[model samples]
Target: MEDWYYKVDEKFLICSICGYHYDKYAEYDEENNTPFRVEISGGYGSVHLETKKGDWIRIYLDGNLSAGELKAYKNVFENCNKEKSYLMTYEGNGFFTIHFGNPPEHFLISFKEYLENLPEDRQNDVF
Candidate 1:
């Protein structure tokens, strides 16, 4: 049997059920001194998502994504009309859908207020 494990931000997290190490991070902008790096390895039969908490969410592989498709997806994530935080959902095939679950607008104001108290560089790191 194949072993499965998850690694988040350099720490290896063992899946209790599979007893395998899955080391994956969702790191972006290596020059930014971030603590993680997003890596995708499985192909054809499986796709894995390793969150910052070292949790592995596995999904069956169904299709491939071209460079353009990937860029479009990232664009959607980075340039969405969202009032707060949001998540992405794959709508079968190779398309993706964005879902917004932002809290109340007032809460967002307060959250932003709190974030503003942090250093300028720290604010840029919110993803």
Candidate 2:
């Protein structure tokens, strides 16, 4: 097997609930030239992997994350095998990103709770 590490050639999203797999970077619409992405449909936490090697994170928060959601994100960012996770929030319509030096190609989208909540239960589990 080839040691394809830190290569953006391949990307995937794995579900932590039903153990489902999805294509992360395969968001391309031929007709409209738009990419449709499906994150963790139903799961406690999800994982996004990129063969490309880079420590960069960009997450858009639309007030969709459920309770303890932010904590989950921090959890993943904190234990990123780095000295410290740098986090910054902007004032642009909830647009935020994280820059990690030598970050792992695999991104574990941590969600505190997916279910067990009534109102936010139906919300899509994605940052």
Candidate 3:
């Protein structure tokens, strides 16, 4: 397992090896909407999200992501559209589908720079 640490000032959970930073709180309130538990091990882990219905949903991250992808995730969380509801969905393999507005405007984003550096066979393989 890689040694990881959190940066309080920036609210980032960073990977020591590649220095990739994952937004700790991202735009969610720590007191309420934040992930209750985040377990990162061997470069990948799960985030436990509390739903509006009071159910806990465990979302897994494969840990293969580029800086752009992380930034996009943060941007989605930090920005508020005029729409009353916004949903961000992790579509596995570092892709995210963001929906905004009542009728919903969809956006798909993923950064392949990091993954492209890996061997061709390992590029799409998840941890």
Q: Write the per-residue lDDT of candidate 3 for residues 47-122, one digit (tens) a residue.
A: 3334344544333455544668656644643443333333343434564444332322212212345555567897
Candidate 2 segments whose C-alpha is farther than 4 A from its true place = 1-54, 81-84, 88-127
lDDT, candidates in the order shown: 0.42, 0.39, 0.40
Rank ordering of all candidates by lDDT, starting from the highest? 1, 3, 2
lDDT for 39 (candidate 1): 41
Which 10-residue window of candidate 3 scores lowest in summed lDDT? 101-110
Over 90-124, each residue of candidate 1 has an lDDT whose tens digit, in order, gives 43344333333332333233446856776888775
Q: What's the true lDDT of residue 101 in model 1? A: 31
Give stretches of model 1 more than 4 Å off. 1-45, 68-127
Better of 2 and 3 by TM-score: 2
For residue 84, model 2's alpha carbon misses the true position, in angstroms, by 7.1
What TM-score goes with each of the models?
A: 0.20, 0.23, 0.21
lDDT of 2: 0.39
How many pairs collide in each candidate, listed in order?
Answer: 13, 8, 0
